[model samples]
Target: MTKNISKEIPKEKRFLIMVILLTGVFFTLLNETLLNLAIPVLVNEMDAAPSTVQWVVTGYMLIMGVFIPVSSLMIQWFTTRQLFIGSLVLFSVGSLVSGLAAALPYLFIGRFFQAMGTALLLPLMMHTLLMLYPAKKRGTVMGFIGLVIMVAPAIGPPLSGVILDFLNWRWLFFMMLPLIFLVLISSIFVLDNVTTVTRPKIDIRSILFSIFGFGGIVFGLSFAGDESVSWLNPSVYISLCVGLVCLSGFVWRQLKSVTPMLEMRTFRHPMFSLAALLLFIGMMTQFSTIILLPFLFENALGVSTVAAGLILLPGAIINGAISPFIGRIFDKFGPKILVIPGMILLVIGLQLFIKVNTATSILMFILLYTLVMIAIAMIIMPAQTNGLNQLPAKYYSHGTAIFNTLQQIAGATGIAFYVTMMSVGQNLYPSTSGIIGGAGRYSRCRDTVCF
Candidate 1:
């Protein structure tokens, strides 16, 4: 969309700039789920229930949902250097807070800061990268980012697995502080202003609506996913209703505002809308697997945290390795070339997962998970690049923000739905089969299944 933009900037300088964004992205994305491996450990060490401890992961995502929409406005209001440096600093502070945390609530405080940092950085990277490269090259660059998205979590779990194996759970955050600081320092030399600052008027009411709107929805979804909470529970229905109501108000506020925080009209483009919907579905399924596999391995299949963490490594690595090439293909071809087969591949993988059980071989699990991950790598970035390509250049920031905002919410929603579905199903049967038994119930409970 940035047709005839500044290719005048030295290619090497651009490369350095991209490296900074990617490294930050890798760290943020890693922290997003690095704790999956640490969950069991945190549960025991922190003296928290499994459900409560899980929020460390879910809260990070939900918080991202709250802030990402505002990033589009921030992109216009601040210099790229200011946003990047500030976000990394906040994330570092969060990591230090988390590493020093002595209690679960303290971890939430730290994670809040961490999530805020990530929420800003993720969209900023995409928006900045788009400003750096034109449409012709986006596929390959976004593909590289796909490598980070696919590989960071792949690496995070096993890496954290080893850390948890040898060190305290707090080391997870402590380990990230150095990486954050390195990126922070690197950004000082390379980060520059890319977009023009309009210094748009801040809509105070819309901000509140977004906070409560997205927050309420994430909260309701979290509650809905808990097996212990009945559908009729006041917490469940009331939260969901309030969330819906606030979200509706938020949408109205956006549509009515001339200078909306998030320009709701980006959906006017059919391709962007379609792309957003598909991206949401893809992230949900991918995250569901990302979160669930560790649970199945360590809890259901009786694997070690280390082994559970390592299980997903191979396929994800392969996906990371090939993603760039896949991007090249997208550059030459187009979205349908990737999206069609990727969707079919994903559906097939999900079908196979339905039959998975405690006895399923680790290699088999890896193979199936790889199928899903590759499908995701194929679909996620290319589809997003393709969708953004369709939009007017002015809407690029809003499009990136929307893409990221939906992505975070989708991760939270997907995790909540699938996790609760499995728990609900497993509790119904009360078997040693764990997620497999849940899958079985899911198959029969057609109206309420996620397998």
Candidate 2:
């Protein structure tokens, strides 16, 4: 049960390996959210519409979603060193191409390559961590992974604001270039293959199903409410329908496959299933808040972009900084103690947002938002660790891939739902004057119209 295969590896070697892996993961995650604030800048500079510029972000996510299922297969086929180095190379090259891109096409292509790398790297890192650490120690290591996940996105908007204040948008990629190169170089020296590779016969049909399934669903949801694409568009519905059908086929095939691409048996464990459900719900709230808060700050309250980013900075920092301690707590006490209170706090924090208005104090917003961040820190890592712990060592790759893929889907769903809600809310007001008459009126009337 203790999968202590890493006992042969020296403690220093293990530490160094983890350091390199963490460094790579940190930057990859940072790159994921880095371009969010720069979308408007790209629109003006590249002469692209908002909808078109959004594909840069959406395309990246789409590729990640599509390719993530294959990662379980890839980890099984390749050594840890091979996948890690390959991911870094792909990410580095993509960053360079994006940084040098003179047109929107080149930028999109570069993002695609970046997504490929991220898809591989995410699962590879998690699987490697599970291999390196024993079950008892995984909570602490995963907490650090949680820190990377929380902190990178937190830094993205503010970092973008500071960069755009002086430099061109390309610096977003360029600034990361050297750090990436350093990690790539160090990884060559430090990283080792921990998992035994078994070359499973590649199922072309399953691969196609995965691509269409995840890709179609994500693409449809991502553009669901775009100005150029109506939610009621036949193409959107077609895509979702195709995605759902293919995804069903993919699951069925996995359940029946002699050597499944992604092990479906992980769900048989009650605790694992429950943990996944909690993580999915938690992600919906986390991603929705992340997308909605900037709109409220910048558009509703007339706060500057820089000020908006700064306002959220403290809470993000606090969220990440406390993750390690939360992980330790999860180790001592089981997940229920941490996750239940965390869920309650998350609900309370979200409910508090119902009262936010033009007159709401910035300090109050920060406090409530920080409380939500704390809840996320408490839930995300603990839940994920607990779920994966329920799996046998052989299923680590599949479990991590499924967990990450679901998280991506959940985030996309959250963003789409919240943005659509905001749009519908604004439309209900009927005029600019009505929207501006009173923030409280707009808030109350948006969801339920005033007679």
**By lDDT, who's the top model here?**
2
lDDT of 1 by residue, 1-451 (tens): 2454548677888888889999999999899878977888889889999989988987887788889888998988988899999999889999999999999999999999999999999989998888888788999998988888788877877788778778998889998988888889888987877876789999888888888888777777777666676667787678778878888998899999888888889898888888998999998887777667766665555677778767878888988988899889999998899999999998888788767655667889889878888898888888899999888777888999999888777876886787677667565656536675654543433222226
lDDT of 2 by residue, 234-257 (tens): 867888899999999999999999
The local lDDT score (0 to 100) that residue 417 gets in candidate 2 is 70
**TM-score (C-alpha, index-matched) for candidate 1:** 0.92
Give all candidate RMSDs, comma-separated.
Answer: 3.0, 2.5
Minimal lDDT window, size 10, model 1: 441-450
Model 2: residue 257 alpha-carbon error in angstroms: 0.3
Clashing pairs in 2: none
Our model 1 lands, by Cα RMSD against the true structure, at 3.0
lDDT of model 2, residue 98: 98
